[model samples]
Target: MLKIFLSSTYRDLVEYRAKILDKLDTVFDSVGMEEFIPDGKTSHEICIGDLKKSDIVIFLLSSNYGSLIDVCRLKEDCKAECPMKTGESHISYTHCEFKTVIAEGILHQTYKVLKGWDTQDKKEAILFEEEF
Candidate 1:
């Protein structure tokens, strides 16, 4: 079973995680980083441990545009814990790294929206063509 870490701005995408999980569980054995960590545990050790166990990281970028908390403000925290690129805005980081990771021939790449019937089952199940 593939393990995937789905990263998105907490303030905006937290609710969306449930919808994504419903679809993901249909095929992959997965866990959300927030779910695995005990409440109030913000240590890098726990976060990185979960990240390390993940086989792929899917970033839900567009979903975070209206986030009130501004996850970018927590850049230092994320940098200390996660494998994602820091400093750059979330969307930029997603766009930049997607190509580099794919060029380096890493995990399967995708960038289009994928949540419930809003995204067709056939499209969601199949890997995307090129970058999104």
Candidate 2:
């Protein structure tokens, strides 16, 4: 059976994920982070594991960069554990996923979400694409 992985900003694409899962599950073994459990690893780590197993990956991108590996501002105790490392800057989970897709040479497709992006956020995804 073909395995497909879906990636996107969760909140904004909740509806999108549902609709696509409904359609693809009929024909493919489609999966995403929604099926994931809190299994001692971070969400980012879990996703990279799933992404490696996928036959194809479909990325739903918007102006929204999505969640961070560790949300410092949102957590009062998050200290210095959340900032991007020097000489290495990836603003969101989706950004890391995009880079991994390329590095792994995975067959993938990206669909721009015109409805969900937050116009106020920085366009870091586009910045990475620009380097390509």
Candidate 3:
């Protein structure tokens, strides 16, 4: 079975992620941060490990950048066209995963949410809290 790693901002893309999992979880070996449990590994390392193991990746990009992580080491290790700016201290987890997939040559697809579609992440968080 082909494993798919879903990458996106948790808050803004909650609905989209849930929908994708609901629709695709059974059809494919779908893995995302939601399913991750603490295993004595940093999120960056865990995500990178998962991305390497996945056969393909699906990225849902939005205006939100997600949590910014220090990418100094990861950036240095990348051999692909990482769009990181010079002297940048941090990069978002979503962006990091996206870059890692590219750097490792993993098959991937991306769905971009329109900028005009406002992010109601805060409100959605409360409404969906424990709802799923």
Candidate 4:
């Protein structure tokens, strides 16, 4: 089975993520932080490890950049000083996952969700491309 990693901000893409899972469930093994990460393991560790094992990584970019909450630290104080190219003071966990996917030289694709546009068409395009 092809192991696929779905990366996105949870709050913004919950419905989209569900739809993807529904489609992928029959054909591929899908891993998303919301459904796959176990309670005992640290999210950072699991994300990087699973991402490396995945056949492909798909990133969903939406309007909200999302917030970074440190799972390891108490009181969510941790912030990653992202590289200059990222153009941000701090990076979220989702950002870290993206970087990991890149650093590991994993097969990946990204799709941007335009505001007020039909997402279903864009999602279908992404899925179609992935199929071939």
Please list all clashing residue pairs in model 2, or write none if there are none: none
- Clashes counted in candidate 3 amount to 0
Model 1: CA > 4 A from native = 39-43, 63-132
Winner by lDDT between candidate 3 and candidate 1: 3
Q: Whole-model Cα lDDT per candidate?
A: 0.48, 0.72, 0.72, 0.66
Better of 1 and 2 by lDDT: 2
Ranking by lDDT: 2, 3, 4, 1
User: What TM-score goes with each of the models?
Assistant: 0.47, 0.78, 0.76, 0.69
**Which candidate tops lDDT?**
2
lDDT, candidate 3, at 29 = 89
Give me candidate 3's TM-score against the actual structure.
Answer: 0.76
Which lDDT value does model 2 have at 26?
96
Q: Tens digit of lDDT per residue, candidate 4, span 30-84?
A: 9887776476867767776687889999888765555654443312322323342
Residue pairs in candidate 3 whose N, alpha carbon or C atoms collide under 3 angstroms: none
Candidate 1 — which pairs collide? none
The 10-residue segment of model 4 with minimum total lDDT is: 72-81
- What 10-residue stretch in candidate 3 is worst by lDDT? 123-132
Instruction: Flag regions of model 3 displaced more than 4 Å.
Output: 71-86, 115-132
The all-Cα superposition gives candidate 4 an RMSD in Å to the true structure of 8.0
Give lDDT: candidate 2, residue 117: 44
Order of the predicted models by TM-score, top scorer first: 2, 3, 4, 1
Please, what are the lDDT tens digits per residue for candidate 3 over residues 1-132? 889989888987788899998777779989888888789877777788888899999887666666777554555666645446476345567766766776788998877776534645543223222221
Which candidate model has the greater TM-score, 1 or 2? Answer: 2
